[model samples]
Target: MSNKKPILAITMGDPAGIGPEIAVKAFSDSAVYNLCRPLLIGSAAIMSRIVKELNSRLKVNSINNVTEAGFQFGEIDVFNLEIHNPEDIKYGQISSTAGDIAFRSVVKAIELAKNGEVDGTVTNPINKKAINNAGHHFSGHTEIYAHYTNTPKYAMLLADEKLKVIHVSTHVSLRKACDLVQKERILDVVQILNEGLKKLGINSPRIGVAGLNPHAGDEGLFGDEEIKEIIPAVKEANERGFIVEGPIPPDTLYALAAGGKFDGCVAMYHDQGHIPFKLMGFVWDDDIGKMKSVKGVNITLGLPIIRTSVDHGTAFEIAGKGIASPEALLYAINYAVKLYNN
Candidate 1:
């Protein structure tokens, strides 16, 4: 294993959103500098403008490759793609220009990682509609990565302090999510969740699988997914020497997981996992009319390269406010460091 500090490439997500703001904000933290040698895979001019508008004291240094990055505190290095003009993008508005820039940055970061130029990637939020408008048809980061890497099996893992949840199906409708609750898929999710948790430093993870129906199907009264699918999946995982408990009631499973009853939870769908994880990570300060802190990392497991991102979205309403929280981005960088070291 390389003992040198890991080099991380951060993709500046939709320039029109909070991506630029938070990227600048996160670099302002000295801790980030100490954790990894970070580079921005976006525009230097736009980042400079954001630094000046936000009145941040950081300096933007444009470089052609990772070797040129200063990786020094108070100075940020950007691998400028020069894909979009700052004047072409409007803050908080969805446009094809912003979409193109965002999509290109991600592609650049992935290329750098695949070529071994960077250790991993830490992405900010990008607008799905805008990306689609730009002609890159994909649901979310996980799909884009899977496509680029030619990976068929991948899952979204949202991690905070005590609560860790992995989605069996994400970026799909509730009806489609239910339709995806097959025994093979459930078993795959369990294996992926367990391996992902272990990568995050958990040894011998105890996974809790949630039931697809009310009260775990009430023993076939409401549904039998538990008996027919979920239970069998859990049994197979256990027989393979995994410490897993599941087909539990969704209502109580999350509560117990949050309290540290389990190392990780396998949610049946997107909302089943996101709502609980967001409830714990997102804090709203009504008095201040902004988030107190956004504190979760969205990690894509079973990818060819390491990828971690902020669990929040593009808060278009607060794009250039300079108050967007970088807590989540910071955590993501730290998590990437952990994974690299492991």
Candidate 2:
């Protein structure tokens, strides 16, 4: 009742996916309501259907604006865009209607954050092909936020219980990702990660920079990227008084980082970071054919507005099964709240 907590605008990702269901599940947790005021930015009709389908005790309060949100548990305040009729969406299938609604919800959340109407934004997963089919051509959530916020320098920071990894180049081809590894870009990501760690309550972060090649280029035998680009970047970061160490072999760096060796890590590409992080955080239940716990928060660093998202993609295979874990979304919302408070 203090009215001091941040108000978060939670976007409904691809309507055909588990976005709506997870939003419902995440809000059902009373902890989320106690920490921050949540405003769901998507179709009220879709959420209403999802609530009924899930047989949840919660109800949806369709509001026209942020000011109308009640911020109450058992009643979700939706900033209804009304972009899709629940009848138009088919579970486990991608359609242009779902894509359009997903895109619109994200754009609206960004606008609210930029205008100071909300403290931060929490996004669920959106299918890339679906959004492209709807004519909004963007690779993923990070790219969309970067373009809309006009943020030139941004890195995707993925964090779970102990491991944290930031990417230098994401949503690009392997060839292009290699070409993107430069000293300046590496340094930039390290700087962003350092600042991000401080926000996460690390007083002094020891950062690790991963090498692009195996065995850190075998001392320039396998490749010279470490000596040419990575070493210089690490040297500069160290000289700048950042507790940084790097040019470590990617094969072993993540293992050490996960064991509490480093505060965070910087990777050369998307999969380099994601593969290891997901391996650690994601748990699949083969018997149920769904995730038991999707446990990572994808935070966009260097953005003017705070934005965090579920690290996992839209689980289209089990969209309406009522079993898609909302753990990742809960983590994302909590992270957004943490960053906003920071």
Q: Which candidate is the best by lDDT?
A: 2
TM-score of 2: 0.97
**What is the C-alpha lDDT profile of model 2 across 136-233, one tens digit per residue?**
99999999999999999999999987999999999999999988999999999999999999988888999999999989899999989899999999
- Predicted structure 1, TM vs. truth: 0.98
**Segments of candidate 2 deviating more than 4 angstroms:** 1-3, 84-86
Per-residue CA lDDT of candidate 1, range 46-162, in tens? 889999999989999999888999899999899987864569788899988888889889988999999999999999999999999999999888998999989999999999888
Q: Worst ten-residue run, lDDT, model 1?
A: 81-90
Q: What lDDT does candidate 2 reach at residue 222?
A: 93
Looking at model 1, the pairs that clash are none
Q: Would you estimate the TM-scores of all the predictions?
A: 0.98, 0.97
Candidate 1 clash total? 0
